[model samples]
Target: MCVLGYCAGRYRCPNCGRSYKNKVNLGRHMRWECNKSPAYFCHACDYKTCRKDHLKVHLISNRHLKNVAGKIRYPCLHCGKSYTMKNNLRRHQRVECGKEKSLVCYVCDRRYYYKQELDTHVKLKHNISAKIEGFPVPMHWKF
Candidate 1:
């Protein structure tokens, strides 16, 4: 096995069967010589990407954001809540309205409607450590 480091070492290209002294040189050779097809060519915007999944995700998220920004429709069934995007409405139903009952703590097996509620429950009830998106869980005491 080749040692993983930032040093020039003898390596072989898998695609072109070419020997290179460094990984960076091998990668450059592959990019310029071996892999010529652009996998992630965006049809609408004419954007080129090497990764197909990234381009797909970009297209999907761009369309979703555009649709969300355009119109406000679709009301929640339970609480009469309205949202501009169907995805947002689905997220709201799952998180805020307690429709799907999806949020559950892995450590304590506590069920919560929203992630915020779950964090509070974990902190207050079980005293177990939990974090959400790098934010520290807030302590809420019932008075």
Candidate 2:
């Protein structure tokens, strides 16, 4: 698919199929983002991110200021639900926090927070084949 706003590709990420114009940019993406779990976390909040710079921004943002007096708790600014582990809070925010699920199953009208979850639900629960139904399976889910 198109990446960086153009489709005439020179390089592509094997994990995510994002195209790039050069190997250096693709290599950088692989090293930093592609298929990589978040490596940086904010000690003050439930904020976690793949890049150190994002964690830095989160720390500087007003969200980090909500840390409870002395206890090591991470509270969601959107929902006020707390988590002890930064990763847990991050997951909660990404998967089930106050934000609406934008991805919906066409067959069942069920909603999901992530594309992978919605794709899986469409595949297994609906018994629809991606090849036959023209459902676009996520690149990471391809066998």
Candidate 3:
């Protein structure tokens, strides 16, 4: 059989047959990720990942310890709500746990708990810039 110039899927895992672009990636996959039991797991839930950063992100994004009593590592000073992650606790204090919904969407008149949420809403739903213009609007604002 005549081989092609550059055979794609040439590098495949021996265990799972998952293809990679290069041998280095394939070797790394086999050594660390491929067919391996997830080394990182959430303490609050069954969520698991192969990487530490992924586990950190999962812990930060989800309210895993909200209802789990005694596991709260970070507690809110104002409302006494608990969180598994410190960053989550900080976010709860800043935007949630009785904070007012100050940032409003000018287009749809929708309310948001945080500035980031409002910014995302405006950018995605309205497809408009979330930046607040200065009192004297700049020339670049013409767009």
Candidate 4:
């Protein structure tokens, strides 16, 4: 009932109801460390950490960015490759998935899985701008 005052066994913090083995640590935890107000806030989301470096790492990491973006981005139909950016997706297709390069462009020697990609290539390479229908990446994409 009275942990703020010294008990029979160990040092206890009444405010948080935590027991410390030593009295010095109890004083320190109550003053600075134990569940203090967040000093660092994440810009991308509502995640907050006690340290500034943690926030920096969370912002720069790929998994955190994807989670913040709600994982809504391009996914390769063939190799099931996922990308948060369109350019990254394009790069993955051109360089990574060599086997899925089946969709060929008659005008130039290029291959892609989706017609939209081929259309984009045609517009950029052959100067033929065609408004092709967008292909939605599957929401149930596996990791």
Candidate 5:
């Protein structure tokens, strides 16, 4: 099968048969985003993924956030639901987490991750420069 446009060939992905132009990219894909046969294993738990970055994500999200209850408690800010991984929490918050964001943009009511993000949005979308409180002023203030 053809992946995107590349035909299945010697450089095709082993998991999905998505062909690539060279081995370096294939190696990178296998090490980071293969849908199957993930070699990197998380010893902190049974979590395994194809990419090494995922392993680190799992550690920071699942292991580091784990508490006295021995449960990964990265809760979705929108809902009370807890997650083992922060990425999962982020996904849930963005999609099906069933929660409302507190930081709503005054211009268009768009939600954001942080208050400063909302300020930036107001400035860009509304053409109103709402400076962040206690924000470090940029140098080159010519008076």
Candidate 6:
């Protein structure tokens, strides 16, 4: 048979005398007529993969996959707190590092390491109305 305007070349069935131009069609006939398994196998990791693209994806993903088989250990530098991932440690450092003491507030002239603390300072000290997520906070209230 012709596929995409190209002849697939003549292929003969080993079990029968039928001749087909397409190798895939011949293989389909063999699967229905004689029942044969595909012989392709992955060389690396000895994993049974159906296609070459699947094997490539497996090899690429295996490099970045975390090794969870062993015990996980991560130590925080600022306050001796430990975590599982370096990202969590970085996030903790951003909030509680205390090395950089000055923090500018967008809503007011006050500065704080924590935004909520700055919001409290703006409300109590400056007597300004501050709204957080649609909730209004009075200047005299401490929250």
**Candidate 3: count of backbone clashes, pairs at least 3 residues apart or interchain:** 0
Q: On residues 26-143, what C-alpha lDDT tens digit does candidate 1 reach at each position?
A: 7876776566666666665666766666665655553533555564466665776666678998888765685556666666666666667876787788786565467443343111
Q: Please identify which of the two predictions, 2 or 5, would achieve the higher lDDT against the true structure.
A: 2
Order the candidates by lDDT, highest first.
Answer: 2, 4, 3, 5, 1, 6
lDDT of 3 by residue, 1-143 (tens): 21331146467776786777877877878888887789898887788878887776565443554434545467565665666778898878776778667656666678777667776887899787756565232332222
Once superposed on the true structure, which residue ranges of model 3 sit more than 4 Å away at CA? 1-81, 131-143
TM-score of each: 0.26, 0.36, 0.35, 0.29, 0.26, 0.25
In order, what lDDT does every prediction score? 0.63, 0.72, 0.66, 0.69, 0.64, 0.55
Compared with the true structure, what per-residue lDDT tens digits does model 6 show for residues 84-129?
A: 6778768768766656545554456455666677767777876764
Residue-level lDDT tens digits of model 5 in 1-143: 55543564547776776667888887887766776677788665678777777766675564545733387578654445777677887877775565456566644768765667766777778777755577443342111
How far out, in Å, is residue 57 in model 1? Answer: 2.2
In candidate 3 the C-alpha lDDT for residue 89 amounts to 80
Best by lDDT: 2
Candidate 4, residue 73: CA error in Å? Answer: 9.3
lDDT of 6: 0.55
lDDT of 2 by residue, 1-143 (tens): 66544466578676798878788888888889888888897775677778887775575444564553444667677776777678998999887887678777777788787777876788899888655767664443323
Of 1 and 6, the candidate ahead on lDDT is: 1
Q: What lDDT is reached at residue 139 by model 1? A: 40
